[model samples]
Each structure stands twice: as structure tokens, then as C-alpha cells.
Target: MSTIADVARLASVAKATASRALSGKGYVSEETRERVVSAARTIGYVVSPNAASLVTGRTKSVGVIIPYISRWFFAEVLESIEQALLEQGYDMTLYNLPSASPERDRVFEYFLARKRFDGVISVGVELSDDEVDHLHRLRRPLVGIGGAIRGVHTIAIDDVATARLATEHLLSLGHRDILHIGGNQDEQMDFAVHSKRLSGFLAAMHAADLPTNDAFYACELTVPGGYEMGRSVLGDPRRRPTAIFAASDEIAIGLIVAARELGILVPSELSVIGIDGHPYAEMFRLTTLEQHPRRQGRLAVMSLLANLDIPTPEDASESTVLATNLVMRSSTSAPRAPLHHA
Candidate 1:
């Protein structure tokens, strides 16, 4: 019912001037801009993003590529990123990227090549060199979370150091028979986070002159996966560990549940520590290293928005590694007795 032409006529300015004022693109006097804006409000006129982008070369939207949406860490990251973008007057388009499949290929070859959004924020998906080059070809800003990417700004925590700290905490409490329960090294997730964490645990164990034989147990990175593994591992009295360093909070919670079911008193019979500050951690009184995923998400959005208009050098990629905080709880303590092998 209303148009820019009508607003310009009512405000006594040229149509181009009205457009520039509304879009905030070209220089327009404050008095003229206020007059045009008042006229637009009076006429119920709204600027069309499609038309505005034609002149400003910005969609005011960001594309997010993530591997999983249901997982706790990923879900938190996505929510924080969406909120941060909205606060900056930007929209979000989410792409749920699946593991190596035909659909995944199409997402890279077709969907991404379209350049529908102003930039991309990749979460927990390590893009290959070809994929990075493809996005670079469009000259759009790119940011990543969960791990580093070549030629891209990334936000992440030091996985190795965090895991080592968790393990060392148990060792400080006189836990010699410790086990690391985490994702499989062979079926590594994006950036080999599973392997990195396991490596840290092993490194800590070795540093203390402790034997690492049969030290790792591979399982899915979820609560249920941990429950099942915990059931079997804790069921065997001969092979039970004095302490466990879970790769995630969910796994640690599951293990605690399983240990309770088997009449094993936590901290008295077994100790457990994990990464992630999952909401349930406090309820379970589990010791953990909180790697604030939501903070990473917000920082990722900040990095992308700040660099959207700047030209980044090809070799100037920077990785911002955040620190993890250690949370002490009732789940970990000194072993009740000396560790004995069956």
C-alpha cells in the first residue's frame, strides 16, 4: 500500500535520497534522514531486504554449518550464536551437515556455492582445503568453532591441556588405576577431539610413571553410550578402575548412575572426572573441566561480524583458544586402598 516513492514525495526529497536514508548506505544528512524515516513511519512503509541487498551487497544473514544439533554442547553453541546474531540485526540459516555422504557432498557443491548468506560459521565440522577454497572464492568471511581451520578465524579450547588437567586432578588424589572412557580413536569426530582428549589422559598418566596398559575404552559420545559401557566395565570387579576420566559430562553422569546401581560408592570406591559443564553436573556433584561451549559460540559470531567488511590476508588466520576451568565436586577423592590387579 506504501512505497519509497510515496515517502520521498511526502518528505520533499528524491526517491534515491529516501532509499539511501532508509538503508543507511550513502551519506544522508541527519535532518533529511529523520524526515524520510518519519514519512516512512507515517505511510507504513517497510524496506525490502532483497532490494536493499542489491545495493549494499549484504544479505544481513549468516549460514551455520553444524554436524549435530541434538547434542548438548552443539545445541548450546547454536543457541548462543543465534542469539548473538539476532542482537547484531542479522539472521541465521542453519545447515545440519551429516557425516560423509551424498547429501554432505551436495551441501558443499550446491547449497554453499549459492552464497545465500553474508558469511558462514562452521561448528565442529572441519572443512577440507577444497571446501575452504570454495568459500574463499566467494570472498565471504568464515569463522569456525570446535577446532582450527586453515585460512579461517576459529574459536576453541585447548582439548589436550584440559584433558590432562582432569587426569592430573585424579592423580593428585592418589588414583593410580585410572581409565579413560571416550569416543573411539578410529571413528574420530571432527578435528579428532576424541583422540586429542585420550592423548592428554595418556600423557598425564605417563608423566606420573604410571602404566597405561588397557587404559582406554571407546564408546559413543553420549549419556546412553556411557551408561552401557559403565554397566559392563563396573560389573567386572576384577577389571574395575579406581578412577575414570570421561571425555564428556554426559558420559561421566552415566557412569555415575551405573556405579550407583552396582552398589559402588563414588569417591569411596571409585572416582570420576570429566569435561564439559553440563547443567546436570552440579546435581550429580561430579568433578569436571568446564569448557564453556556457549562462550565459544558467541565469540565465533563476534569474530565473523567484526571481519565481515575487512579483507583478511590468506595466511593471517588466527585461532583464539579459550581456557577451561576445573570444578571440584564430591565425585573425586583419594582411593580408599592400594590399587590391586586381578
Candidate 2:
């Protein structure tokens, strides 16, 4: 029920002075600011975010656009972003953009146009030039995670190189009959992550002079997707690969589960390696390349905040690539014997 006017009266200051003191905008003497804040606390007065935004040209809120919420990577990234924003005294509004939905257009053309957020962090959602231009026209600071968009600030790991390293790990362990269980290239979202990862696998195989025929299998980028593909591929001992380089940790976990159900011993009969250091990776004892999505998410927020502070069009758009580390575990080992093919 208390208002800024009441607080101003209680503090014996003009409403404008009270506004300046509370918002930390314009010039207000430190003594006067303390008095105004004391009065506001006494009266339980709260500044209207809308009014403050009008005065400071900032909502103190951010919009996060993401493709999948249920997946491990996206969920971890989102949790990190939310925690970082909260610590920075900001709010997050999430927009889940499912594939093949008109909601993406509505979010860009309507919701974002409302100026409810001061900035945006897009996770794995590629933007068209027009979309990027629209956000730029509104002067909303934008940061992308997972892939690059032309003319947009981005934070991502080297997808191709990471994949190459994962494959190379398997190769170094003397894995000749290797298979890649990765995302479906044709069904990939805007970023073409599936294609990039597959390219990395192929690049490593070619570099090592390994066989490439029938080496790639397309699946959803989830545990269940990997489980299904693993069942089909690892069912027959004669056709089983010596090792599998899964595109993600979730997929690798799924394959491990499937292999267990099929009575196939891992590392002894088949080896598995994956990307991401998912929480369950250690339990599964899966060797992996850890990209640390949570850290990437937090860094994305930091990048957006930095850009907001010094928003020069030229300086705001920079691409940052993070690194990945190889984690050794029980799931990967050299084949027991040379694989023979008829």
C-alpha cells in the first residue's frame, strides 16, 4: 500500500529525489540516498520495475530461448543461467522453442518485441538474419550458446574438434571397428550440430586411415535414442563394433544400458566414449569429453552483461570458444583381439 510519494514525504524529499535515490540513477547525495532508502524500508515501499525500466532503459530481466528443456545439456545450461542471473539481481524468462512450431515466430515477432527483457541468451537456437537484425534494431543485447550466428555474439565449444578428439581417443586405444551414434543429420535443429559432430568423426577416421564404411548411425540426441540405436547395432556379435563414439553423454549412457540388457560386456566386448560430463557419467563409468555446459551457460550470462555495460555495435559481437577435456573411465579400453571382417 506504500508508494514512492509516501516515502518521499516521510523522507522530507521531492518525489524525483526519492526516485533518483532508489533507482541509483541521476545524481543524489549519499546522505540523501540513505535517508530515502531508510524511509522506503520503514514504509515497506518497493519501486515498480516498469517505472524503473522507463527511467533507466533496462528491465533487469533476460530472455532465454532454448530448443529442448528435458534434455540434460539444456537443463544444466538453464540451471546455471538462472542461478547466475539471480546472483546478479536479474530475472530470467524462458521461451522453449520446439522444432516445427509457429511459436518461434511468435516469440520473435511478438513477445521479444514487447521489450520485457533487457537482453537475451539463446541456447542452441539459431537465428535468421532477420531475427538477429530485429533484436539488434531493438538494441537488446544478445548472446548465443552452442553455435554461431552471423553478426551475433556467441559462446560455443569447438564441436568438430571435440568430436575429433573423442574419436581419436578410441583410435589411440586400438579401436578399429568404430561406430558413431549421433544425432540425425536430417532432423537436426537450426545449428546442424549433428552434421558437425559426424564430420568430426569422419575427419578423425580419415586422418588415422581407418575404415569409414557404415561407420555412422543417426539417432536422437537423448538416452532413449541411443538405447534404441544400440539395441539394433549391438544385437549381433558378428556385426558389433569394437568401440562406439557417441555424440553426447546421454546417448552413450543409453547405449551402455542397452549393452547391459543384451549381455554385452563393456570395455571387454565393446567400448563407449561420449561428449559431456553428465552427472551420471561416473556411475556408468563412461569415458567422455567434458564440455561443462553449466560453465558455458554462466559465461554466456557474463558475456551478455559485459556487452550491456559497453554496448558498441562493433565491440558487442565477438565469438568465444571454450575448451573440452578428456575423462578416462572404465568404459573404454583396447579391443581384446583384432576384429576380423569377412
Best by TM-score, which number? 1
Across 1-342, the per-residue lDDT of candidate 2 in tens digits comes to 999999999999999999999999999999999999999999899999889889988889999999889888899999999999999989999999865568778888899988578899999898888788888887788999988887778988898999999999999999889999998887876688889899999999999998899999998888999999999999988889989999999999999999999999998989999999999999999999999999999999998999888775733457889999999999999888856899
lDDT of 2: 0.91
TM-score of 2: 0.91
Model 1, global lDDT: 0.93
Q: Where does model 2 exceed 4 Å of error?
A: 9-17, 26-35, 99-102, 314-317, 338-342
How far residue 3's Cα lies from its native spot in candidate 2, in Å, is 1.8
Most lDDT-accurate candidate: 1
Off by over 4 Å in 1: 9-14, 28-43, 337-342
What TM-score does each of the candidates earn?
0.93, 0.91
